[model samples]
Target: MRNILIIGATRGLGHSLALQYAKKGMVVYATARYSTPQTPSHGIHWIANVDVSHEGAGRRIAAHWEEETKIDLVVISATYFASETFEDLHWDKEVAMYKTVAIGPVFLIQHLVHSGLLKKNSRIVLVGSENGSIGLRHESGGAGNYGGHGSKAALNMVGKLLSIDLKPKEIPVAIVHTGYLRKENKEGFFEHGGVVKPDEAATALREWLESFDMSKTGEFWAVRGPADIKTAEVVLGPLDTLPTPLQLPW
Candidate 1:
């Protein structure tokens, strides 16, 4: 896409995606949490104080958009991971998690659509997680991290509803498990059971997105496929049986 807008572009996959798009001479609009957003290099126009966890986060983006041209591809990659055990939990963190991962997207998309910043052919990609899938939970059987997983689950629902709402406009919305990401500065894919580096996940997803369209709207997917998922074989099918850009169950 020529015009790329990436929310939560401070670090991890968002940062890498922004850079990749900018390097391709595409117009990139990225956001950071604080007023003084980092400008690592030229081409990426960073918006300030656009915390998704807060209300009206999309307004911040619109305010800084000098040219509110229709965005071709919009990737919302903001996620807050809060570890919670059966013995310990934080209510505030969970609320923030939901606001950031789930609730925020609703308003963000609404703003984009209402402001005429998204076209009928525009694509909206939400970064949800495989851990969010209730259908896959029976096989994985992991406990705790309620907020982390729950928020993503909520995001899946959000994406589904957004897809339906935008259907009349012919816009497409989809959620994806971006893969178990290692630290942004990490090297090769190692440890944490195929925890991939940010750039690797970004590259795989960018390539796969070329074919994504209305045919795949309202669906969930694993951009890099079942290779990095722990419960993929048991929950879905044999590793070899699954395709690389596999569509995931809700």
Candidate 2:
């Protein structure tokens, strides 16, 4: 069975991925910012307080596994979003977003690689966004989300650099656009226009992962294709002309 580690598994896409992988009978190690539940699902193991924004988070995760446990996959899906405009930008929120989305993954992966937790053929998937694409900024229509968009763009660069470093070890690094997800609030759950549910995103992401290989390392992809990206037509082209599991521009 594959040994998979999913960072930020307490909720959203990471939670769905953990459940899906555990159902497949894989050894799933999931990290949460809080205490692990006493009753975790079968095949799922929880690592508590592995906040990606913390510098030591990676080392903490690496220490959890035994020497013989070679992690086949590591998916870092932790993210922080704080809406901002030029006049109302919050400094603390921006710092947190940068740490979670861009800086933290680099140090964490470095620690894992140095500690031998990630071995040859192991894949690293960085959950990013289409908003990260500099080319897609044209679709923003002057709407501002400075921290979220900027940090993800930084993440894409980080993933590319890590891919170059890990190439000698035959480790493939991929950055993915998980999709525009729906939001749940006290007002009741609501879809954000063309947003997808977390379960649907997880399924598509899993299918995309199955086909990922070294040849495609350092590339950015949209697992949900053009279906959930409202700006796909405006930015890239018509949806009908695009392929499923679209290869995204950097």
Candidate 3:
């Protein structure tokens, strides 16, 4: 059975992926930022208090799986998003976003690899956003989102650099745009027609991972294809013309 570790697996796409993988009988390890539940979900091994924003988070996760020879896949899906316009920018929020989205994954992956948790042929997937793409930024709607977009762009760079460092070990790193997701609010959930459910995003992400290999390392991809990207037409042309699991520009 495959040994899969998903960071930030408590909710969103990470939660969906962990549940689905466990249901398929894979040995799933999931991280939580808080204490583990008294009765955890079946088939999932929970690593509690593993906050991706901190450097020690990866070391804690690595210690739990020291006996395992190798981890087949590791996905860093932890993210922090704080809405900000130029006028309403918050320094604290931006720093938090940068720590979680860009800086944390680097140290976490380093710890995993150095600790022998991730070996040759292992895959590392960093969950990024389409908004991170510099090439796709057009005047249509490229304003605002200072922290979210900027940090994700930093994440893409970090992932690419990691791929280069790990290439010798045959570890392929992929940065991906999962999908435009719906936001859960106090009132309820709200989303546009193009926004996909977390489960849908998880399913698509798994499919994309199946085809990912060393040759595709250090590349960015849109797992939900180009249809859900609102600005795809303005930057890359008509969405209908693009293929599913499209290769994204940095």
Top model number, lDDT:
3
Query: Which model is ahead, 1 or 3, in terms of TM-score?
Result: 3
What are the per-residue Cα lDDT tens digits for candidate 1 across 4-107? Answer: 89998888899889988898899999888876454466799888788888768877777777764688999999888888998999999999999999998899
lDDT, candidate 1, at 3: 87
lDDT-wise, the better of 2 and 3 is 3
lDDT of 2 by residue, 1-250 (tens): 3899999987789989999999998889999987876666787888998889888998999778743778999999989999999889899999999999999999999999998888799999999998898876674556588999899999999999999999999999999998987787778669767788888899999999988889989999998887766577888898899999999888
**Ranking of candidates on lDDT, top first:** 3, 2, 1
After the best TM-score superposition of candidate 1, give how far the Cα of residue 102 lies from its true spot, in angstroms.
0.3
Once fitted onto the true fold, the runs of candidate 1 whose alpha carbons sit more than 4 angstroms away are: 36-39, 184-192
* Estimated TM-score for each candidate: 0.94, 0.95, 0.95
Q: List the residue pairs that clash in candidate 1.
A: none
- For candidate 2, the clash count comes to 0
Q: Give the TM-score (vs. native) of candidate 3.
A: 0.95
Measured on C-alpha atoms, candidate 2 has an lDDT of 0.89
